[model samples]
Target: MKAVMIREFGDPRGLAVVDLPVPVPAPGEALITTEAVGVAGADVLIRSGALAAYGFREGHIPGGEIAGTVTAVGDGVDPAWVGQRVWAFTGTGGGYAEQAVAPIGEVLSLPAGLSAVDAVTLGSSGVVAHFGLAHAHFSPGETVLVRGAAGSIGIMAVQLAISGGASAVAVTTSSTERGRRLRSLGATHVLDRSGAGGPDDPTGYDVIIDVVAGPDMPAFLDRLNPNGRLVAVGAVGGQPPADFGTRLMAAFQKSMSFATFSAATVTAAAQQAVRTEQFAAVDRGELHTVVHEVLPLEQAVVAHQKMDGGEVFGRIVLLNSPFH
Candidate 1:
């Protein structure tokens, strides 16, 4: 099988397409013939070795989310799953290949009318968005602010917040077109992070979903309502403030709380349940997976390049196209 492996940690250039033995499913697992894989910033960070502190190793396959079909089921796995189309979270690696292995219990059967491409885009981001909204205990009629609104996870967060009956306000860079796109995804308002029209008055929002952390932290903390909850899914801008004192003080003063989500923090069962709900939402026409582009698996390098260049609007998927 051909897989995208980070031979050395550096840039997207380090991601090499190489031949590797197809993995067989172990007990409680199933082998999936990969059809599509979602490319995101996490893949770039892993390739650059920035996430080494998180246990990501060099020479590891770099994909984390995938959509594929079950070809075989291993011992202790239900035989009925064979030949079923499913989407799964491949925690660390194994997604950027012709075939990947996932625990049967971790796979979610694609809901009616959902395609592999769309399902793959839901991946970890959608699940995290769901969890963030759930953790916030968002309710109808309340407004939630989503930082990095144009990002993959941010976009999903916007939609999830809306689906949960809350209004979404998104903060993004000076990209009017992207702001419009986010509004279409359920964001009630869009603020330009690069310009004067910034996030509105602090303490106005019921929940703050911060996907980018940096100098904005102080202002974001100020904008939270009393008892507001902030969920940080990623630090697209940079690391969190070195002085946790100021941020913690602000949170305490406002009676606010913060939470973080990572693959390690999510269990297999939870992933499956989230995928099922996401797929159902897609099927019910309540949520849509916005795919910006799709490239052939062999052109995995191009996918990484697009993501690194920040040219991708939504999800950039890798399909098994012969053109690659």
Candidate 2:
């Protein structure tokens, strides 16, 4: 089998393609013949050594979600899964290869009409958005603000907020073109990323789904309406200032709250259910899946470059050849 590994950190060019023995599924796991791998911000973070504190290291295979066909299953797994098209979560690694193994519980059958590329794009991101919204205790008719609303997770947050009956879906994006695309996806207000929030309407957003958290994150706290909730799901911009919480404290009278969310907090069963629901929604046309481009597995370095360049509007999927 062929795999992409990090020869060094801090540069996308550090990603190198090499050959390796195919891995066999362990107990309660299944081996997937890789078809499509989602190139995500986490992959970029890992390759750039930004996630070193989280245990990512050189020689790591940086992929989390993949869509493919099941070629084999381990003990305690259903044989019927073999030959079935599915999407699997590879935890935080092992997906930058021609083949990967995932626990049977993390594998899901592809919904009818959902392509491998689309599945991988929407799989883990959709689950995170779904659960992140829930973590904020989002309610129908409440206004929502999705910060950094350009990537797959941010895009999913915008659309899901609208479908969940948000009174208005506002987003913070980097460019006019990106903002335009988000508006077409049902965003009611498009604000500049630096602006941090919408116009000063005393009644601000009832919920804020933030992906970018840095020194600027404190600015959004004031944008939340009284009793509003802000959930930080990603920190691509790095951690906020140590005193960032002072804003929430200063606004204590408003009863506003701030917290962070990770899909790991949710159980595997819940995550799988949300992924399944999201896939079905995309297949049924109630949801949208955005894929920027598809590259061959060997071009893993190129994929990381696109991610680090910060211009990709959505996921860049890596495709694997069946012959490999």
Candidate 3:
């Protein structure tokens, strides 16, 4: 089997595709012949050594979410799963290959009418958005705001927020075209991502799902209604707000609450549920996965480069070379 491995940290240039022994499924796992895998912001961070504090090691394979066909089942697993087409999380790594292993319990069959490419595109970001919205508890007939709306997770968050029943879905994005895209996806308002154009309503927002939390924390906090919740899902912005503590103290009077969410903490089974729901939504045409591009598996380095350059919108999918 062939896999793309990080030769060293700090740049996408170090990524190399090489032949390696196929991974064997352990107990409760399934060996999958890969179809497609997601290229994500987290993958960019992993290649640059930015997530080393999270304990990422050098030489690790670079994909986490994949859509594949089960070729073999491990100990204690039902043979019925051996021939099913499934989507899964390979966990921390090992998905950027011709073959990978995923726990059988975590592997989900592709919902009818959902393609491997589409499912792979929605894989991580869609699940994160789903789990993040679960934390936001967005309700119908209420206003909701999605920060960094042009991002993969942010894009899905916008659609899910609408489907979850928010009467008005406001989003923050840097470009006019992207804003138009979000509006077409059901965003009622498109605001500049710099945290500008706020304090629009004193009643504030019923829910705020923020991914680019950092210096913009106070601004988003101000947008929340009394008892409103702000779910901080990511920090592509780098710096934490300098006055976060003081801002929190001042913002405390509104009775709003703040929580940070990482899909990393969510259980596999729980995430699988989100995956199933989102896939069904896509299949039903009630939701959409905005994929930017689909590259061949050999171009893993190019996928990482585009992500690093902030040149990608929605998600980039890598088609496993096996079928091609």
Candidate 4:
């Protein structure tokens, strides 16, 4: 089996394609023939050694999200899943291979009419969007302000918020063209961060989903309604200012809640359920996964570079060229 392994974390170029023995399913696990894998920001962080303090094991594969067909099932796993197409959230990393073993609980059958590419694109991003909206306890007629609206997770958040009966205000750094794309994805209003008004004046929102943290946090907190919630998913712009105390005090005084999410803490069952729901929405034409580009597995380096360069507007999938 061909796999992209990070023998030493340093840069995207450090990911090396090497031949390795195909992974076999362990107890309660299933071996999947990798079809499509989604590249995420965490993967890039892991590769660049920025997350080295977190103690990720060396010689590990880097992908966290994958969709493929099951080829084998391990002891305690039902053989019925063996030929089923499934999507999985491999939290620690192992999806960037021809064949990867995933715990049965982490895998979900692909809902009718969802393609492998789309399924992979949804990955953790879709699940996180669902969780964030649920955490905010949004209701019909409520309003949501989503930062990084043109990105994968942002787009998913926009669609999910709208589906949950909330109005979505998406903020993006992309051009007017991309803002139109976000609007088509269910954003009631698309605000360009690079434009005149900026992200600060997000008036009338009951909830704010800030995927791009840093200075935007204070701006978003200012826009939140009393008793509203702010869900922080990513910090694209380095770290927040050291004097974030003022904003924290404001949130407290306003009775607003601040929360964060990561796939590591999200249970497998929850992810599977969200995946199922998202797929159903896609089938019904109520939800869509925006895939910006697809590259062959061997071109994984290019995909990583694109993501790191902030050039990708949505999910970038790596296809298992050898298996295809």
- The per-prediction tally of clashing pairs is 2, 0, 0, 0
Which clashing pairs does model 2 show? none
lDDT of 3 by residue, 1-324 (tens): 888999999878889888899888999999999999988777888888888898988888988889989999889999999878999888788999999998777789998689999888887888888888888777778788888788789989888888778888888887888888998998888788754654552246888888877676787787778888888888876657666756557877778888889987898778877778888989999889898999999998888888877756788999987523
Can you tell me which runs of candidate 4 are displaced by over 4 Å?
A: 194-204, 250-252
Candidate 3 clashes between residue pairs 3 or more apart in a chain or in different chains: none
Specify the highest-lDDT model's number. 2
Tens-digit lDDT track of model 2 for 60-169: 98898999999999999999999999999988899999999999999999976999999999998888899999999999999999988899999999999998999989
TM-score, each model? 0.92, 0.96, 0.93, 0.92
After superposition on all CA atoms, how large is the RMSD of candidate 4? 2.4
User: How does candidate 2 fare on TM-score?
Assistant: 0.96
> Candidate 4 on 1-324: residue-level lDDT in tens?
999988777767888898899887889999999899998877887887777788876687999789999999999999999999999876678889988988889899997688889998886788888887777787877878887776788889888888788754556556778877887777767666732344554565788787887765676667678888888888775566777657858567678777776656777777777788778878788788899999998888888888888768889999999633
Measured on C-alpha atoms, candidate 1 has an lDDT of: 0.78
CA lDDT scores, all candidates in order:
0.78, 0.90, 0.83, 0.80
**Candidate 4: 10-residue stretch with minimal lDDT:** 194-203
Model 1 segments more than 4 A misplaced: 194-203, 250-252
Worst 10 residues of 1 by lDDT: 194-203
